[model samples]
Target: MQPDDVRRTDVSTSPPDVKRPTRRRALVAAAVAAAVLLPAGAAVGYAYTGEVPRGVTVLGVDLGGLDRAAAGEALRAELARRSADLAAPVTVRVEDRTARVDPSAVGLAVDVDATVAAAADARPGVFARLFGSPTVDPVVAVDQGRLDAALRAAVGDVGQPVVAPAITYDGTTPRPVYPESGRVLDPATAAGALRAGWPDAREVTVPLLDVHPATTTADVDRLLAELARPAVSGPVTVTTDRGDLPVPPAAIAKSLVFAADDSGRIEPRVDEKALRSALGTGLREVEVAPKDATVVLDGGKPKVVPGTDGQRLDTAALGRDLLAVLPRTADRRVAGTLTAARPAMTDEQAAALGIRERVSTFTTNFTGGLSAPRSNNIVTIARDVDGTIVQPGETFSLNGHTGERSYAQGYKDAPVIMDGKLVPGVGGGTSQFTTTLFNATYYAGLEDVEHKPHSYWFSRYPPVIESTIFYPNLDFKFRNDTPYGVLIDTSWTSDSITVSIWSTKIYDSVKTEWGPRRNITKPRVVHLEPGPSCIATNGIDGFTQDAWRIFRKDGKELKREKFSWRYDAEPRFVCGG
Candidate 1:
């Protein structure tokens, strides 16, 4: 044979799989070159030249043999749904409970650019590209810790709380309440499931496990058989020093009660008030009334008044006897006793408290300026503050004593400070009463806990020392710093309201000193249309000032405290907009 014929025979004997791929590529290259040369085949040549490697796919959408731009467009179009779903928050369910979680908050995201680039990078040999189908997993970023936290929050309270055993009275009979089981969710497993399923799904349901309570049905059964059943079985005769008292089954049911602790153990407690009430008028005849000592204002000074003590049934002794005799089916007789009872406030305790004289008094004159509604609000607040007694070491809260002053609470519409102008608002003109009370507390040498000065200076109030109050937010509070009890006495007329603090005088007198103003700023004028909502104001200049409180004893200064404030300018508002 010739050399050329021998070489051709050798090539033909090679494997068909390897030989076929090489031949096919050569033929395609020849066809591409031919198509480029021909005038009408240029478009087809352009299409085949820039195509990606065959058999490449991303997320199940086929992108094999397509150009780079087309591949990217198709990839983005197919993944648009998952991308949007990833941005939206997902809801997680566990039994009846459900909560929402944001994928971004949990550090979960789909990397589209990276995924497309990866698909572009796939370049295999011709045979493999033709015969094999390759899949590119999309790029997904996940933070394990953040994902766990989000899933944990989303699965909050996934289980029901265990119910403990208890007992209740059914009119004259005792009934038992059995314990119940519950379920709990597994957060770690839920997070793992979400990481795999999210973006593809908007809702995930986690599995739950059973949980048991500390107290069981057996405990309820034991309690019912041992204590509850026999206690209300028969009548119990209670004997006081005077005579015998009858407690029937219904009364015993009212008196007996059981409480369960955290450890699920039942403890019996006596309702002394309920037992006395259930005794049915027999106890009233045997018991005597006791009086409490009180302080009264006689003439102009406060005086300690004496009180009396009386005889009453011993509650502790009665409880012990009743509990012992309850379990017996026969001879249910309990012996109780009458003992001497003391008043809540003894004469010695009342005498120890020093409330003898008028320590300080302040009166704000509203004589000519206040309207009828304002006067009514002032008098109403004054009546609420009257007869109030402040014990030693107690903090008095003005807001706590008087709740939100609304129309339903008997306050009327009047002028109030708002936006640097006087507007008609409900519960207006109450600030005058607040300022009066503040001055009274100040002169009494009490500790000011909290107080806010007016935004602009008012000529009617003492500069830098008075206060303004609004409901819920702004409040006037003071601590009674003295060892003596304080008696707050308020009196009002049509024109003025006076608040007086009465106690044994510790300081001779308290006085205030003003400081010169600084940082003065001029006010601006503004005009608005005249309407019911419009409020006109004569603007005041802004300034910073200080005040000093001087405490005196025996005509000499004891101590002094400094208070400072900064005021804002009140703009001149012309109601003609």
Candidate 2:
């Protein structure tokens, strides 16, 4: 390409807006395109096959007097050496934080073939080869979009995100979550800085931009005063059809929540479900209760109460009503409208349970140690569960009802079996009470949720069917699977304890058929010297047995289930101490 001489145009003759292109500038732009766009290996191959003018240098390597093959070989060796250096990670820095990212991972490459073709573009005439030395630009390939993403990950999220203002209710008090300013590293600028430093720079410091949150401290303070503080200032009265449902400040606090709007201003929202849960048993007094169809013991006879739907305060609209009155300082009251409510147990479901008679009655007589502390413990736990009511489909838990029996609760230490030996334990002999209750529930054909028999066989209780309980750990539980409500009644004397279960009888009777004992193992005899802890015992042999339960309704077999258990051999306690 021919060069154009520089000539300054006269301002008087030419228009200011009109600018002309130079011939030398155009040729230089075309030469750059030839070098940069040498994207094909065939072009590199063709360039290497050609003789280069002397005084040419690529990356400070003189190809000045080299042949076609020699020039290509030298260029490849130099590029390979640079590639090894590029294998090290490119260090990135943002303030004090520094990270090392792999060159290939960030889509950076030497592009050897393209660079080789580009280096072949440097040419000099005979006179210039003797006097002038020129340098060829290396083609460093970079994927801009990929580099931006890689740099963003290498530098941590630029900085922290802005914390928006919000409010939360902590019991009866209102609390505020304040907003804060943060910093951000612009992706495009960071990527440019990284590219300029990579494979050559020791480290690059990324520029940071300060950011401010949409919500300010003033906004949070305004919300706390206007909405949060007043919401839980005092109790709110909601008038129902029957009486007033008083919602305390604690409940009001639970219902109040804060959220940000489109303009980032904090706003209040009432949660109806949360409000109902916070209200708890208070709703039962003011709201008209729905009567479920159930059988109850009336005048010592089974009686059915027909199901009836009742009208209660409309919980769906309670939030709206509460929201209107929450911010008021005086007379924070709202009139709640009534809505129809349905019973969980309908009349048809109660009738199907067949709980119209005394289902099961059990009596167990306690001998030996009748006047001991064990008897007192038994009576104490028994009285706690007396007249207990088990609703339909409800699982009655003995441990849950009577709670942990301790000396504070009037329980005394007594001899109890633990680790195959008789040891003194609190709330002892309650296992007898457990056995009695288990028998009653078993005869009633109730659903037994959990039960565990004794480690050793005892003549006092039935085999493979008795239950033992230890305060909080071991428990006897039974579910009233029938629709009829179960009434647990207990009575205890000095020598006898009796448990009777009353419910509408679904089955005429539930009977257990015994199975012959097998795999009998004799007990090991051991003697303890005379001491206060010494207790004598005549241990029974261990055995495995299976018993079948026969359920009969209207004198016909309804269903049959099998029960299996393995009893460990009880050690003979020959106390000589």
Candidate 3:
């Protein structure tokens, strides 16, 4: 126990303490080795088992230590439960309205197999597995087309469309209807947000965007102030060589067309057709037509008359200039461009017409008891057709010259032959003028283009050779076939009308040959008149006749023209039977 004895004992005890620590170290090493080996053995066993590691979870569903098949079953069940929960309708707010949509209806689904596989893959390495497996969310699958359609349908219910600006015209002014802004839910963005956070969030707000109108109030105001109002403010005066054509404000307003341009700007345009129509009679009055030279017989010789040059207003150029000046407040007058027009026949052409002394003349005598109105009508028709000139190759229409013989042209009711009966009608005596004119043209060797014989053969007219005319429907037409200008000269007294053709003679002589009437039929007995308007008259027998016109030069037969007519029988009428 003293210093030497205490030192020897402490040495022995220290050696014992060192040996004890070595044994303790050996025990600690063995414990650490066992800890590593157990987990390694468990990992090896797990690898051989073909099963998911313990504590693995997918979307909060545990599938610990399960084989692939069992894991898949568990995953399917969990996915079904989760999907059903997510199938709850989520409320979507668009503007002030709300709509509910089931996430599954929009093709939202949980990819259970993929999610399970991902969770299985998240299992840590052998060392980390000793701690725990990771928890992973389920993979979500979405059908974009279905989701887009659903979102659009929902948006359509709540969206307010934008109103476009429009223009309306009053009698004198133009007014603008203003545009309005609108709100619409953005379908694509709203669908994306819903897909990302749906089910978890019970409510979602739809993204809204403003829709602006293409045309605004300012645009309408600009159009009215700059284009529409100025176009119709004042008259546009077009000064031509003839006279001034003042287009009134109302006419300009009617001609002005307002339309939108490619850039969507409203502008004014002049409608050429409308402007021409508005000009109408005014334009025709200002038009100066070229006058052709005429030929006349001067003492049995041909005489040439000179033609006059014509000045015509260029209407197209005037329209353009008028449009240019329409926007101006002052100096609104524009001079129209004049175009020169040459006549078809000149003085040389007139001399070449070959007009000379009278070629043929015919006179028709009417009964002296003809009413004053009938005599006046015959004289009036003769006067109207007196100075008519037919150029070579030109056809003359008697109805075209005389027009409709009615009260408007001072014609009076007179006796006329109509429908195989004599009746009192307007322009009754003009047929006498037609018969005289046809005979003169026939003897003059003119070509007959169109002519109609009277329905009933009249003794007063040449048998089967005379022509009759009605207003516009029926006409007596003949062509001036000779290379000459033929002048129609008409003269009439109280009971006789004469028509003479003055032109260069092409034939030596012309003669008419009449045949006896054949196939005659007896007239029918007349019935009583229906009213006082009916006139009693004696009937005539119906018959057929043939006639011919023979033209000869130097006594040799040149040509012979034959004509035939079949007249219907007339019935006798008793007025007071």
Tens-place lDDT digits, model 3, residues 409-491: 87888877766556788987888788889999999999988888887667788877787877887799999988888998887
Q: Per-residue CA lDDT of candidate 1, range 349-445, in tens?
A: 8777788888888988775434588888888888888867787999998899998988988899888887667789988878888999999989999
Measured by lDDT, the strongest candidate is 1
After best superposition, candidate 3 residue 183: deviation in angstroms?
A: 31
In order of appearance, the predictions have TM-scores of 0.52, 0.53, 0.56
Residue 140 error, candidate 1, Å: 53
Please list the C-alpha lDDT of all candidates, in the order they appear. 0.79, 0.78, 0.76
Assess candidate 1 and give its lDDT.
0.79
Clashes of 3: 0
- Give the alpha carbon lDDT tens digit for every residue of 179-251 in model 2: 8776667666666676555545657777776667677888888878877888888888888778888889888
The 10-residue segment of model 3 with minimum total lDDT is 259-268
> What clash count does candidate 1 reach?
4
